[model samples]
Target chain A: MAHDRQPPPNPTSQSGLPLRAAYGIEDVPADHRASIGILPGEAPFHRGCFAQGYRTKPWRIFQLSGYGKPEDENERIKFLLKTGETGFLMEHDRSTADHLYNVDHPDVVARREDVGMTGAPMQSVRDTHLCLDGIPIETTYGHAGGAVVQHGPFALAAYWTVARRRGLDLASLPGTGQSDFFLTYLGCVTKQQVPTQAGLRLNADIIEFCGEHLPKWVPVSIAAYNGGDTGLNAYEELGALVANAIEYLDEIRRRGRMDITAAASRCGGVNFRTTMDIFEDAAKLRAARKMWHRLLTERYGVSDERALRLRIHVVTSGSKMTYQQPLNNIVRGTLMALTAVLGGAQSLGVSGYDEALSVPSEHAHQMSVRIQQILQHETNLAAVADPLGGSYYVESLTAELERRAWSFVDEVAAQGGFLATLDSGWLHARARANQIKEFADEQSGRRVVVGVTDFTDDVSPFVVDGFPGVNDAYDVALERLRAVRRERHEQGARKALVALEARCRGSANIMPAMMDALDQEVTLGEIGEVYRAVWGDWQTPELV
Target chain B: MTAGQRRILLVKTALDGHWRGLSVVAHALRDAGFHVIMGGMISGAEIVRAAVDEDVDLVGLNVGGHTLVVERVIGELRAARPQLPIFAGGVLPPSACRRLGELGVETYPPGSSLEAIVDAARRLTQVHAEPDAAPP
Candidate 1:
């Protein structure tokens, strides 16, 4: 009981906006001060998309490694790619990939010690080739762990059938899969899914099957960092991620089959979170690349300046980590990884100074990669690209957060858009009214969450005890699901589970019968029993 | 204080649904009046048949996995409600909150506090009166 730091008389921001002790160029709005003198790969790119940012690409140290057995998440993704981690994320096992269960699924054999404690119970394609064994995947950039939208066509057809059994070339594969509708229709709501209109027709059939054969795949990303860590407020996570990329570019232009500028450059590889509000989350990645170049040139006329440049990827928030001075969350993951590298993150992922308790104890994932390699080799912050570009309080909070995120994307297009405000829970009651006004501003000390509500004395005798992953990940995923149901080809895995239940009852693309039911080994609970017998779940709604 | 309404329940000892910390501790135990009951990711014989068919006087859980499946659902809800009273929260870890505080449960974890989880659900459902004398 010793709190007296005094700063909150009115300072607002984590989406309540208001803070201004000094900002002027007439508080930055006359047409965003003419795009603050343009340049950083121009065209409303909000001074980014790279004019030598991180001196031509440095921000990619992607993390989110996996947990227990698929060879213990392939030896913790080859120990985060030999402890530097410039891209690798596979984490699938939300009690069997968000309930596509197997590991003897009677609700995962009645919580068989919660199977690989949050990832690494791959299940088939020989446990995703023992979680991609020698991890080359044609020069790694992978993240094929279907961050759940009915486990994204079985984790991108088991990471493109282990990169077409290592000969590679599903049109030269790369990464990213998250079949996200804000991570299970609004950040972690999976009790069983497949119903935001069949997860928007399976993310418009994985953006028209990655515009015909994984064109360097990033197929379905749309993770507004799971709707701003499930309480959406950086202008409602940039107006529900531009109303979820206008429902995946109006269901790929009402199915004209590719070419809405290559499906807005494969929905411009998004993902945002960067939390410790450092200048409104570095002016929310410069107002999310000026609202993806004003939603692809004023609603889809697009004209491709690389499909209007919005390629962010930040992670940092994990509900702004603080479980009573856990090493003050490595200085809140180095000020949200230097606010995702001065808000121009091309890729990042800090969240884990034992993130509010568990997951990531390999020294809190090598201190989240030595806080991004000491902000990329001792802070010249990669010699600037949009280092708070023309700051009049970050261009008046990036033009008032793109004018209140285009009026919350016109109130999610008058509520019949972003999956009809996530099937009418109205964006989970606007992320439960910003998580009850951020837990009523940390229970009214006016949000002073330092060491959890103002320096609550820790005396750190250091104790983390988190990542307790492999306890024989459910008896070795029930002996590799009974040796892939007694070694494969059982009538070609029942004719690839009857052509993946006739392409989930005929629409067309269920990722080529989910890569022929993960190449006839068909197991993740028999493709979640043919998607719980053709999408008969998702009645979810009652969120709270 | 616990004459009429008390209830509680909760559930999710893991199949990982992530109901935002069980929907903010079931909206602070239904804003302190109690009667919660979510029970989402079930099974420990369906949480001892919903704690002897929802005659719950407290049972929380949540624990997104392994403290031996929340000590086998707190030994099947203390073998079907032996004076029921339990508490837990997600992503535990501080040695699984000292082995679920040596099995007498009460472990909130992740920066807990919806007024210390509704004052530990009004002292584990004895409902010691004043939340404007309950029943809102």
Candidate 2:
């Protein structure tokens, strides 16, 4: 099976725009006068989000920290904090946490050695407590370790339960929980997650719950980073993100539990990925803010300027980092970070050089932090907001992305909505189509990723025998699950589980019942058991 | 040359569902005329069952977890069908790649080209094509 491939001799942008020799007056005439008058803080905010960008609030250095046992994750968080990390994201073990299984579940037990490969084993609240040990939850803007939709309620409730134990007020506490459909349904599809319908209900419940209490918490951030990394192009990423937001807002409206404007505000904090394409991706951030503002105003009639402002967090593309010359990824990480920074991101996480191999080593984690730190301190890049605001090339690209993204959103709309696309594998087909092209592009030498496709020779002295995380993560997690099962009040746990099962089968909010379950020290797998019984499993669409 | 299509079984040994890489490989192999059976994120026992039951000439394991798990899955596959030619590609670190290579399972870590993977698949299935070859 050979391909009669046509190698593109000339350079084109990742979004398929052929490069021009130079952009003079023809790119955008009158671009610098009236259109450029829209400053950083103005409406249709493609320029920037804030009046003063990193000057007022520097992008949060929020590298995800986890691995090994609970305490190991805690130690790593503290280490990151001491090493100039402004914020931390708790990462729950993917096998146990993402699937909402305990270490003892038959599925998890099959490959027990892989239990803590990605993150800490946060089965019960006790384990969550251990993961959050000594970390200042009151002051810190932390991610509560629930990246999956089904797992979000448990993760948030457990974190809030700990905050309550410390006598902190819920209204004033600041943090976020990512009940992202992209992570759950698209990027890393778990074995048996709740269907996307159930996921939307869970996320909407979180939004309403957060509205009443936990006012400062960004309940469910739509992380299009996962979608982009999975192979959605720039405009597609933007389109899918907003389309995803509409699912949440419409669900909340259907419930009629909270104000639509308030719901829009709660879900405004979004995440995008910055890849190697610096100008286009930066323009994507600009386009994203503009699209978000328009979506809130035109659709929902959101009048609050603050509610209209979309906060952006950029996670540098992990799949972009090469495995051949691992150290070369440091430069890749730095460049992606700069792309995010130049795009006026409110937060950033550079993928560790050893990202493809395993969880970050202490050194790799430090390097991730240093990359952000260097951008913030040494580089004068953050001195002004949207420094590339008036550039004819950037503005043109931003408008082009906005035009394409809206059309993508409309395509999603025609297929019912975002969740419908996931259910029907429509979005997956789109991603796979792009994936084929990307691989073929590289195969035909149209794309030259250094050390992977073109510069195949490596002469570096540095040997990054990728970090294999803690070996005892499984053993420790198994013991802890057993101990937690043994130590907690059996009756209280049973009572909580029964009540939780009732809510899952009924129409009431799942968060209150979830909080009760967390209060009674119910294990993640127990809640998972109830969910599986009540909701059954999501019939995952044919992926390949 | 084999008269029928060269069948290849691609299974994710670990439960983690990072299947984008696996999907691409499966697509590439299918394009190259191998009968690619996606066994999905299944257990070791299930993977072995699929390999033997499907009578695949080559097995591609998407290692989303530890090499130890992959090693155990490979052991199961080899025990079930001693003549099977196995290969792996996923989040395999340098050491894990070396470890799997020692066990005669070719490793394609991240950034591996589709051309190389397809070539490896053809070569591996060819090596395991005949019935009287030395046990792998």
Candidate 3:
């Protein structure tokens, strides 16, 4: 029920690329170099990450699941796993985890009812344990919920400590902690947290700590999906993600801690977002791998083939889901999932049909999982590798995207770097410009957003209201925090906090102290206090 | 453009620090000749404090969390200034929008145009006509 309207004589993609009615061999640009002859899994691995693709290793069906009390999120995780999810991502409550405030903190206390609206409030190891109650972390891929930069060390340590207690080897454990800058600094800026320089230290520490141990863990995934959904167009998202990788590699190199090759491999597991711009978004994934290869080989002088291949996790853009006709988003999710499959994403999460309204209901989440299942099994998607490999239009778009992205990379470089752009509000300005333009396009009927703009004849009888969430989330979390504080051995917790504070102040890897702190049952707020004392707050630039 | 230049205070009810929506609304209001004060990720007390301190004509809220949180903020604002008009936009579900609407706060969910939001700001502010609010 969308996109059926006749074109406006001239149409452009979300990134402002002029559209055409038809294409041929000549449409593929003359200046565009040959990715045409390169095979999948080869150098400049934009075609596909693997030669046979889904035949060898199917893309991981990863979904972000959490809300309310620890047990509530735990039940949801178990349900997702039971219903054929390949990996689990634990989401920490934004109110508590994002700001590193326990439920009892004054700011959190001010808004008590909002505690678990975004995610489960996991304050200590016990809460994390309850969240992972029956999940087999040793065998399965786990996401320790540290999407915010400041909370990374605490979140990872809590998850790792739980694994160690279950007699799982840290070296063999497979998981990731998203110490992503784009999520906070660029996308969702926290109210008060460590400055970007300190956040870089936290991420670098995680990388070094994971390099020495936890070989299987993707230490800190740069989820550029945050940057993308925030308002970055396709090429800008690709360019900014590359610029972020450069920052990580440069820091690791400067420290002379781990081999840059190994660091590149660990940092390669990044993320991007797909929206309603189906073809452009699909081209984005293709452009991403090639850019990674170019960045590592041309810039970093890295040669290891294993380290060169970029493993991407694609999340369908959440902002694209409309509240006007919520059920239409199910179709939106499916099409975006299909785009990811076409683009050869290594992992994917389709935003729920009720995404604009609230966190996905049980049924909404199940539909998210089912969307991927149907794509993998019912369709013949898994039967081919690089199915769009030879399409003239796709290849032209791929090359066009790469060229435009490199220019954007240069644009970011002139702003100092990705992190500098973030700090200076340059990146936010770019995102804001694009956001205003896109909104204006929709407002002027230059863009038709299906049920939102043109086709508004939705007649679904289902009452698809947003998730109400558990009423007792705040009370239960408050009780849990009190219980942990009252029950944990105080002296040990104090010692660990002191040590963590020292590590934050000194030039030491903060992970060991963080792990010890978590093991000693130190709460999230204590760690927050230490970081606050050490780094102070990031003065967010004037956004309005 | 109106009886006088209107001032609006935009505050985020939750600590979820996404400024995209708030910034867009502020841009539109300012473009339409309203003085917009962006209160970044503040609580109800802080929001009320800003509204009263700034002596703004209208208060615009950006809700990223629960309806209850918005309700609490609405109560605080009402207590502080009875004549103050409040309008909200963000990730408000239909139910949350209805709940907030029942409290006399005009709710704009996702997909609501900037035109509608700016129009509401003008209308809500004009409804709150006080002799002191107009710039002499």
lDDT of each: 0.82, 0.89, 0.89
The sequence of per-residue lDDT tens digits that candidate 1 reaches over residues A1-544 is 5476678888888889898788778988898898798878887888898788878789898989777788888888888889998889888878788878787868778878777776788878888898888989788899888888888888888889878878788887888888888888787877777788887888889888888988888888888988888888887898788888888898789878788988899879988888888888888788888888888888888887887888988889887887777778889889988988888889898978877666787778888988899889987888968867898998898888889888988988887788878877888888887887788778877887877766777787877777776788788778768877887779988998998888889988888888887888888788888878888887777788
Collision count of model 2: 0
RMSD in angstroms between candidate 1 and the native structure over all alpha carbons: 21.1
Q: Pick the candidate with the highest TM-score.
A: 3
The residue-by-residue lDDT of candidate 2 on A1-544, one tens digit each, is: 2243345677777877666766654675453335676989888787887888778898999999888889999999999999999889999989998888888888888899898788888888888888889999899999997899999999999999999998999999999999999989999988999999998888988999999998899999999999998989999999999999999998888899799989999999999999999999998999899899899889889999999999998999998988888888899999999999889899999999988778898999999999988888898988988988878788778877888899999999999999999999999999998888898888877777877876667789888887767889888878887887888899999999999888888878888989989999899999899999989999899999
Q: Write the per-residue lDDT of candidate 3 for residues A1-544, one digit (tens) a residue.
A: 4456776678788899887887687878775546677888887898988999988888899999999999999999999999889999999999999999999898998889988888999999999999999999999999998999998999999999999999989999998889899998988988997999999989999999999998899999998899988888999999999999988999999999899999999999999999888888888999999999989999889999999999999999999899988888899999999999999999999898999888889998999999999999999999888888878888888888999999999999998998899899999998888888888888878788887878888778988789988989999988888998999999999999999899999988999999999999999998999999999999887777
lDDT of 2 at A407: 97
TM-score of chain B of each: 0.31, 0.91, 0.90
Please provide TM-scores, in order, for all candidate models, with all chains considered together. 0.37, 0.97, 0.97
* Cand. 1 Cα-lDDT: 0.82
Q: Candidate 3 — which residues are off by over 4 angstroms?
A: A1-5, A30-33, B1-3, B130-136
lDDT over C-alpha atoms for residue A280 of model 1: 89
TM-score of chain A of each: 0.38, 0.97, 0.98
Lowest summed lDDT window (length 10), candidate 2 chain B: B127-136
Write the residue-wise lDDT of candidate 1 on B1-136 in tens digits. Answer: 3568788888887777667767877887887788887878888888878767767778888887788878887887776565677888878878888878887788888777689888887887784333211111
Indicate whether candidate 1 or candidate 3 has the larger TM-score: 3
Worst 10 residues of 2 chain A by lDDT: A1-10
